[model samples]
Target: MQRRIIIAGGGTGGHIFPAIAIANALKKIDPETEILFVGARGKMEMEKVPQAGYKIEGLEIAGFNRSNMFKNLLLPFKLLKSLGQARRIINEFKPQAVVGVGGYASFPILRKAQGKGIPTLIQEQNSFAGKANMVLGKKAKKICTGYDGMEKFFPADKIVVTGNPVRGNITQSSVTREEAAQHFGLQRGKTTVFAVGGSLGAKAINEALHPLLASFVEKDIQLIWQTGKPYFETAKTAAAAYASHVKVFEFINLMDFAYKAADVVISRAGALAIAELCVVKKPVIFVPYPFAAEDHQTFNAQSLVNKKAAILIKNDDAAAQLGTTLFSLVQNKALMEQLEENIGKLGNTNADMVIAKQVMALIG
Candidate 1:
């Protein structure tokens, strides 16, 4: 008999990508497995999930507003409505298992699924668990975590340290640096620094890089920048003066190539980004977003920094320090190589497969 499952999550690429990777893994393990995704309406996953070749159902839900209390007045109604919608979807799909990957829509869907006695699993991608996942952990049949010491969040017995699921294209990349540079129209003579601030772009990182564009050219450094949507035009304009040495885009769809071309990386320390960087085994300068829930991004970067596998720059200091830091690191081939070796040891190339086995075991 074909096994049917539903995976729920997504407000950001961090959640969406892992959810898709797990879904793909399940399919690979059992070609007859039927997978469906549940995400918040109008969120990135609504678009990205289908792009990954999966069926998705969107719920009308939103997270609590920490800034404006008035915006949260409707949260209760939205939650109830989303729960009802989730129940309807579950009834129609009749899934044997429901997995939650920690996003705005995850709580209601998993909560409803658990109430119905369906086997449930929640994948916690951060070193610190989010409030949504914390609440769902109690009822979850299994809790898969990306970092160690997760006993601080979920039950120790329930937790499985599966690491985070990185996109298969990245872990299995066979693209050579020369081929990647040629594809991106970059010359191979100089060190290449790749900067990405997640799927939406980080305003601070964009602003920091804007002034240093010409300096990178002057230093004979090549850059591949993913400026994200809001900063694309500005980044494009800034890179125009250094056309031969710099490339800028709102989003880089060809990330495998970008990873190959990067001798070093500048990025926000989102869990998914950290996972991909580890798998790529690149030296990274992480400017963790300060406002991440419980300041988890800093913890994520600190974990690697403690092992001397990556550099850490506080978000507040990035603008003033990033340029100098990049220049210094580019000149220090020894330190870069050291970071590469240590970080490569931390990579988990089979996280997707691990999660797949756990999901099947819990549901079976």
Candidate 2:
């Protein structure tokens, strides 16, 4: 008999990519395994999941609006409608297990699955668990975590520290520095710095680096910058003066090359970003998005800073401190090498497989 499973959630690349990684791992483990993805309608996963060659069903759901209470008036109705839709999908798919990867669609599908006495797994990808995951964790058969000490959030007995699954391209990258440099239209011998601020772009990171483009050129340093969409024009205009040394992108499709080309990285401390950084083994200075739920991004960065594996800059201080910090770190070869070695020790390249096997265990 073919085993069927439903994986749910996704809003950002953080949630969507890891969810796809798990689905891929499951297929690799059993070619006969049937998988269906459930995501919030109009979310990124609806498009990205299909691009990855998987079938997905979208729920008419939206997350709670934290900024404007007026926008949340229809939230309850949306949730109820989504729950009904989730039940129909579950009844038709008849999945042996359901996995929630954290996002708006996750709650309805997993809640409906648990109500039906179906085995469900929760993959909590943060140092601090969200309200939805914490509530669902009560009935979950297993809670897979990306960070240690998640017992504070979920049932300790059901928790398994599986580390977050990173995209395969990064974990198995064979891109050399020369190839990466050529791909980005930069030179191999120059010091290269890569900055990424998630998929939406970071205002602090962009503002901090804007005035420093000339300094980068003067120092003969090369920068490959992913400005997201909003910051693309501004970043492009700023880099126009130093086109030879700076490459600006709205969204980088080939991150494996970016990682290989970089000597040091400046990034936001999101869980998936941290997971990929661990695999790439680059010396990283993390500027945690201060607005993250429970300020979890800060906790994520501090975890590595405590291990001497990475550096942290508060979002508020990025404008005043980022350039100086980057310059000093680039000059310190020993510290860079030390950070790279310690961070590499934290990478778990097989997390997708481990989580897949656990899901299969639930099926048995």
Candidate 3:
């Protein structure tokens, strides 16, 4: 029988990319498997999902505003409306199973699916589960996790450690170091550092690195920096004086090359980024985004730090500590190699395939 599945989530690349990876994996395993994405309207998934060649339906939904009480007045109405929309989508699509990837849209769709006795699976990317996932986990047929010890958050029997699914280009990249350096117009034999702050760019990282451009050139280091859109112009302007050693981009489209070129990386400790770094096996200095839900990014980074697989610099301390941290790690060959080896052990290149098979099992 032909299978149909709904993958729900979005808001950030961390959520959307994993969802897409799973969708692609499902198709690869069973070409006739039909997949539909459910995301919140105006979120990145609406555009990204379609671009990945899947049909998507968006609900008029928004997460509760924790910082401001006044803004949450209409949240009840929105939730009620989205629940109705989710029900309609479920009925119209008749999915064999629904997968929740942890975003505002996942709650309603998974809730409705569970209520109807349809199997639902959740992909919780963070070590510290989000509230939405915690609630939904109660009724989900299975909960796929990126980190271990998630049994504390979800039912132990329902939890499976699948690791986070990373984009194929990253996990399967064949880009050589020489090709990577040439792509960035950088010279070989110079230690390269790739600093990325997620898809939208991280302000703390950009600001911390801005004053250190000259130092990078002085040390003969090469930098491939993704400054995100907000800080791009200023970062580009600042990096112009040392153009030979520094490359500044608003967003990097070819991340595989960036990973190949780097001896060390500076990144926000988002789950997806960590997953990719592990797959690529690079020594990383993580600056956890402080405002993340439940401060889960910190938990994500600490998980690796505990395993001796990565380093952590708090967001508040990045300005003062990131530069020193980066320079020291890049120069420490033994530590870098150790980190690379330990982190590599944590990478699961087949997470998408594993999750897809799990979803298929629920259908059976």
- For candidate 2, the per-residue lDDT at 345 reads 93
Q: How does model 3 fare in lDDT? A: 0.95
* lDDT value, residue 251 of candidate 3: 93
Model 2 is weakest, by summed lDDT over 10 consecutive residues, at 62-71
lDDT of each: 0.92, 0.95, 0.95
What TM-score fits each model? 0.97, 0.99, 0.98
Residue 222 lDDT in model 1?
92
For residues 223-325, could you state the per-residue lDDT of candidate 2 as single tens digits? 9999988989999998999998999999998999999999999999999999999998999999999988789899999999999999999999999999999
Error of 2 at 224 (Å): 0.5
Q: Select the stronger candidate by TM-score from 1 and 2.
A: 2
TM-score of the candidate numbered 2? 0.99
Candidate 1, 290-340: lDDT as tens digits: 888888899999999999999998898988999999899989999999999
Per candidate, the number of residue pairs that clash is 0, 0, 0
* Error in Å for residue 91 of model 1: 2.0
